[model samples]
Target: MAAILTSLRNTVIAGFVLSLVLILMFLNWGGTLDYNFCAFLVRWLHVISGVMWIGLLWYFNFVQIPNMPSIPDDQKPAVSKVIAPAALFWFRWGAMSTIVFGIILAWQNGYLLDAYTLGAAEGFSVHKNIAIGIGMWLGTIMWFNVWFVIWPNQKIALGIVDAPADAKPKAGRTAMLFSRVNTMLSVPMLFAMVSAQNIY
Candidate 1:
């Protein structure tokens, strides 16, 4: 247990092993591997990826960005050159995984078009569809910002890509502002997602 706990990869593997054990203990394998079960698994994966994505996003907004100014200039390179890049790698990939799995979940549940269209296929009559549609759209927009806007600008701001020195400050500010925009949208997006679950 100690050895597993000391290594992140082992710890994650152990967690999945435990989950599998619990599933096997509680469910009969013969009846459980059906469409609904697969759908539930996809939903679970979607949720886990989303937690990774949003957790890092909040960490940046609520912790790192707000506290950066207090750090001395000499030590700032530790964050800029090392920690920020590592965190951004996970952040961007988490966003990608989240969006991919979310779309798969939506498709598996047979609401891809309805939710995307915000229930327009059914004449806007389904409240749940509308709710999830809003969440999906917001999440998609956030994903887009993370990839196309934030990541490119971050590469410049972090000096992973060469840019004119004057351009760095502008790139950093753009990334920060867009991150803030995503943070603002996150609350409502989460609300819509949760509301969809209970709207029926």
Candidate 2:
């Protein structure tokens, strides 16, 4: 038990197994599995992943980065080596998962392109279309940074790949700056996403 709990991989596997069991139980207890059900599952995945991504974004902005300079050099390694990497593992993957599920949801509903374009008149009511379009654009930009800019630099910063000593700090700063930019965009992104559903 102690050994199992100590290994992060084993712990995650165990947790997933337990959750699968519970979900199976729910299905047995009259949860109708259908397209809508599948869509609901995907949406749930999107929500969960979005929370993790944004949560880490806030953690970086609100807590970790601000405190970094004050942390003793020896102690900083624990954060950079263990904590930040772990958080980022979830962060990048969460961003990917959110985008995947969101796309799936839109596609399944037969509005993928329309929503992307803000539901241009022929396809949807004007207001709702525009609102969804704004959210899609924000999500796209966030996704772009997550994959193109942030991940590459983080690889260097975390020393996941070999990098010149001087290059590492530069990479780290670049990643951090883009992450802050994402944080700023997230405010409006979330607002437009939620407001679209009801307001328009």
Candidate 3:
């Protein structure tokens, strides 16, 4: 138990194992369970990934980035050399996983085309599709920012890339700005997605 709790891989495996246990305990396989169950599972995974992604985003904004100036230069390497890079790995993957699961969930729920097309698909409620579409588009943009704008710049800022000395500061600023852009989008994106429950 302690080993599983302490090891991330083990912990994640345990979580999935528990989820399976719960599903088996409650759901009537092949009789009561159907596509809805799969949709729920994917939605659950999507929410988990989104939480990891946004939690780290907020941590960077509300904690790490803001507190960086106060950390002494000597202690900075702990954050820069070790912490930030590790966080970024999960951050980028979280974004990818969230988007992938989100799309799968939408498809499972039978509104993928409607949402993607901004309510143009027949039989889907325009309002609901618009709401979910807004969220999806916002999330997509955030994912793009994470992979392209932020990660590339962060590589330079963290000295992972061979960048000119004068380029580091600019790269850091670009990453921060794009991160802020995602942060700003998060609120509306969340509202759109959540509010869709009632709308649909």
Candidate 4:
């Protein structure tokens, strides 16, 4: 138990194994679950990944950034060299997984085209798709910022890339600004995602 607990990979595997066992016990077997049930499962995964991504995003914005100045200068390497990189690894991948699973869930639900096109597709009501569409667009923009803007800048800022000494602060600021942009959008994105179910 201690050995498994000490290893993250083992821990995650154990979790999956436990979940599978629970499914076997609690859920009907023998292909009893259908397409909609599978889609619902995918949606659950998407939501889990999204929560990880946005939770990390908020942690960086609300905790790490503001507290950076207060940490002793000599001890700051613990954060920059170790913690930030680790967090960013999970952060970026969480974003990627969230988008991937979200798209898959959308496709399974048969509204992929409609949501992507913001209800421009035939047979989709504007009211139903609009809310989810806005959420999708916001999520896409946030994903873009995470991959293209924030991660690149963070590489320089965190010294993952060979950046000029004078450029580090600039890179850090750029990353921060984009992260803030995502933070601002998160509220509306969450609203749209939730309202889509109840609104129409």
Which prediction has the highest lDDT against the true structure? Answer: 1
Per-candidate Cα lDDT values, in order, are: 0.94, 0.87, 0.92, 0.91
**Tens-digit lDDT string for candidate 2 (5-73):** 999899988977887898799799998778888887887788888998889889988999999999999
| Candidate 4 residue lDDT tens string, 76-95 | 99999999999999999999
TM-score, every prediction: 0.96, 0.83, 0.92, 0.91
Model 2 misplacement above 4 A: 1-31, 121-125
lDDT, model 1? 0.94
Candidate 2: clashing pairs of residues: 118-129
lDDT of 4: 0.91
Clashes of 2: 1
Give the alpha carbon lDDT tens digit for every residue of 99-137 in model 3. 999999998888888898889765445788889988999
**Which digits, one per residue and each the tens of the lDDT, describe model 1 over residues 1-200?**
89999999999999999989877975864556778988888888989999999999999999999999999999999999999999999999999999999999999888989999999989999999999999999999999999999999999999999999999999999999999999999999999999999765
Model 1 TM-score? 0.96
Q: Per lDDT, what order, best first?
A: 1, 3, 4, 2
Best by TM-score: 1
- Alpha-carbon shift of residue 143 in model 3 (angstroms): 0.6
